[model samples]
Every structure is written in C-alpha cells, then in structure tokens.
Target: MTITLHHLRYSRSTRIIWLLEELDIGYSIVEHHRDETTNRSQDDLFAIHPLGKAPAVDVDGRVMMESGAIIEYLIETHGAGKLGVAPGEAERSAYLEWMQFTEGTLAMPVLLTMLGPRFGGLDKLPLLQGFVGGEVTKLLDYVDAHLEGREFLLESGFTGADINMEYLLELINLTGMLDQRPNAKSYLERLMARDAYKRAIEIGGPLVKLPG
Candidate 1:
C-alpha cells in the first residue's frame, strides 16, 4: 500500500516518521509549515483533518489524522505479525497501555503546560503551567520507575509504544521540565541511540530548526 504522511518537522509528527522507519514501511511525505501568523497551517490540512493537525496519513486513498490513531492504524495494518506483538498477547496489552499513556495522558499535560505560557503571560501562566507540569512530571516519574532495569516499554524489544513515549519524553526534556528525573534522562539517551530515530532527525533536519 502506498502511504502518504502529511507532516511538520519536529512536531508530534516525528513520532509517525520514526514509526514508519522502524516498521521499514515505504511511504511518501508531504511537508508543510505551521503558519507563523496564525500559529497553524497555511495550507488546507484541515480539509484533510478538521483540526489541521500534522501527522495525518493517507493510506492507499483514505485519510487518517491524529497521531495516536494514526500510529494505532499503522501498527494494526502494516505492523501486525511483524514490528508489533501478536494479537491477544500479553505484550499487546502492555503496548496499548503505554501508547495511550504516552499520547492521552503524558503528552496532553505537557502540551497544556507548553501552551500556558503562550496564551497567558509568564507571570500569570504559572498556575496552569505548574498544574500541567506537575501532572506530567508525576506521570513521567511513574514511567521512569517502571522503566528502571528494563530496556523497553513493552515486550522483549522495541515497539511502537517506545517510539511514542520517546518523542514525548524528548519534548519534556527540550522544555527543561524533566532534568530532575535521572531515569527519564537515561531513557531519553537510550531512545536517541536508535538508528531509526537518527534517520528521522536527518530527514527532519532542514524542515524545522531545533532549539538550542
């Protein structure tokens, strides 16, 4: 099947790119920018996704949006019997758990904390920022504690869960929100060691500027 990923570099879309590379699936990418003026896409990504979100995928001819949904679809269709755990396997349960945790819980709080500063002034934003940041940190602490003495989030080896979590963890680090957690730091390092992630970085290099 021919897959087309509509993505923006360095955004949550990177998770999709990493997943594709990990699965070794052949796909094409359509790169676009989030408009500086509106802080959204200049193009009609919303025509494909009502929210104009990145990381939307066109599988064959059908379009799918939302990163978590996109990842689940890819894994279920192209990744089953291969990169992911078999159906009804215990690892499959664990995989779904981590994937939902990463996107639904972990990423939501972190993203809210990030937006607090933009929507409210720094001085006034501390309440929401602290609330969201505290929740995200708590979740990260749980994950960090769980990951201790283990190599991956689920199963005996890497899976889509790790790919999902790694990007969120990196976002936390980039925001200077995770420095106090040593296990998270270590886990982030291990994630960076993956060749697929390195390739994603190379592909994304010129599309978005990394913060120093």
Candidate 2:
C-alpha cells in the first residue's frame, strides 16, 4: 500500500510516524512547520483534509485524518498483527479502551492546559488552570496506577495503543505532571528509548518539548 503522511513538527502526527516505523512499511512524509509567531499549523495542510490538520495521511490517494483513526487503520491494514490484537484476542477489549481513551477522554483537558496560558497569563487563568490541573491529575493518576507492575498498557507488550498514548503523555510530561507519576515516567522513558521511536524522531523531528 502507498502511504503519504502529512506531518507537523512536534504534533501528535509523530505517533503515526512512529507506528509506521514499528510496522516496517514503506511510506513517504510531507513535512509541515508551525508558524513562527502563532505556533499553529500552516495553510498547506488544508489541501490534504478539511480540518487542515497534521498527520493527514494519503493512502493510495485516499486521505485519512485523525491520528487515532490513522493509527488503528494502519495497524489493521498493514501491521500484519504486530502492534495490534486481533478480534477474539485475549486483550482486545483493553486494547480498544486505551486506544479510545487517548483521544476521547484525555486530549481535551491536556489541550486546554497547554492552550490556557497562551490566552491569558498564568496568574489570570487561575480558575481555568485549577480545573484543568485537577482533571489532568485525575486522568494521569489512573493511567499511572494502571501501569504499575506493567511495562506497557497491555499485559502482552508494546502495542499500537501505546503509540496512540505517547503523544499526550509527552505533552503532559512537559507540563511537569509526570514528575510525580513514577510508572508513567518510566513508561515514557521506555517508549522514547525504542529503536523504532528513535528512528521516528529522526524522521519527524523530536517532539517540541515546550509547554503549550
């Protein structure tokens, strides 16, 4: 299958690149840069999808958007049952839960945390920050607790669900939240150390590491 990935530096799209590497498939990358002043995606992305988002993948000329959807599709279509658990598998339910959890439950508050300070100074955004902080703490605490005594999200091993999760965890880490969550911290470090992840960094550029 032909895959063309529209990648944005330091964005969630990096997860897609990482998974493609883990799958060991041939794909091309169309790199996009954030605006210097606004730090938002460029207009070039609109040509790829209506949302004009990064990680808009063109597979066999059919465009796919949303990082989670793209990750799952690639796993099902090209992963050869490597990073994903097929139907009737032991951990399939858990796999699906974590996959949806990244975007469905976790992304909003993480995004608000990052974008809050930008709209207003930290001092002025106290109420907003307070609520967002609580939500982030609660969610990550659950993740960290789940990760205790486990290497990856699943009992089996590293899977596409972990790749789906890495982007948000990295952003949360930049917020200084991971410092108190030992299991999550170790988990992120382990993910970053993977050879496939290292190669993805080389291709997509490292995650920005700057707080939103």
Candidate 3:
C-alpha cells in the first residue's frame, strides 16, 4: 500500500507521524503550512479532504480523515501486532477509552481553553470560560488519577492509545497545565522521551511554540 500523510506542522497530525515511525512503515508525507495571518489550514489541504484537515492519510488512493480513525486504521492495517490492543484483550476497554478520549471528550474544552483568547480572552466570556475550565479540570483530574501507577494508558505498554492521548497532553503541558497532575506530568515526560516522538518533532516541527 502506498501511504501518504498530509501533515500540518504543529498540529495533531504529528501524532500520526510518530505512530508511523513507531510502526516502521515506508510512507511519504505531503506537508502543509498554516496560513500565517489566520493560523488556519491552507488551500493545499482542501484538495486532499473536504474538511481540509491535517492527519488525513491517503491509503492507496482513498482519503481518510479524523486522527482517531486514522490511528486505528494504521494500527489494524500496518501495525504488524505492534501498538494495538486486540479485541478481547484485557486492556481493550481502557485502551479504547483513552484512545477516543483525546478527541471525543477532551478536545472541546481544551481547544476552547487554548484558543478562547483568539476570539476574546476567557475573561470576556465568563460563563463559557467557567464551563470550559470546569470540564478541563474534571478531565485532567480523571486522567491524572488513571495514570497514578500506570506507565501507559493500559497495563500493556505503549499502544496506539498513548499516541492518541499524548498529543493533547503535550499541548496542555506546554501551557503549564500538567504541573498539578504529577502522574500525568511524569507520563508525558516519558512519552516525549521516546525516539519516535523525537523523530516526529524533527519531521513535523514542534507541537506549537512556547509563549514569549
């Protein structure tokens, strides 16, 4: 299969890059740059997928979007028994939960919390800020507690779930949100240290820059 990854620098697509390196697959990348003024995706991505999102993979000719789906597909098709928790496996439920949690539950508030200032500082939207803040706290606390004694999301080490969850954790970490969650902080540290992740950073650029 000819695999082509449409990658956006500093976006969640880096997760796919890291996973591809981990899987040791031969694939090519079609790099896309964000619009400087808007910081939104450029027209190059629009030609690949209708939504013009990064992390879209062209497998042999069919385009696939959605990071979670792409991650799951890559694992099932190309993973070679690596980075996946099989059906009926002991950690299957936890694996699926954490894998989906990044986008399904954590994305809205996390994105709003990070990008809310672009619209207006959270101060300007007090109620929305309050709701988003509450959700962020609740979700972070849950993940932190889950990571207390675990090295990865599941008892089995280093699955796709980690790839799914760690990208969001990296964003939060950059904003200093992981400090209070020691377990999560430690887990993030461990994940960032992986060679595949380092390669992803080198290939795709850092996951957003630190505030000046």
User: How do all models score by TM-score?
Assistant: 0.88, 0.94, 0.97
1-212 in candidate 1: lDDT tens per residue? 89998877558788888889888889998886777666677556777777788878999899888777787789888885655766688787887788788877787887776556567644576776677767987887898888778878864787777877887777668776667777778888988888988888777643234547
Best by TM-score: 3
Judge candidate 2 against the unseen true structure and give its global Cα lDDT, from 0 to 1. Answer: 0.90
Poorest lDDT segment (10 consecutive residues) of candidate 2: 114-123
Better of 2 and 3 by TM-score: 3
For 1-212, candidate 3 gives per-residue lDDT tens digits of: 99999999879999999999999999999999999889889889999998999889999999999888999999999988889988998988888888888899998888888887778799898898889999999999999999889898888899988988887888777678899999999999999999999999999999885567
Cα lDDT of candidate 3 equals 0.90
Ranking by TM-score: 3, 2, 1
TM-score of candidate 1 versus the correct structure, residues matched by position: 0.88
Evaluate all candidate structures by whole-model CA lDDT and list the values in order: 0.77, 0.90, 0.90
Order the candidate numbers by lDDT, best to worst.
3, 2, 1
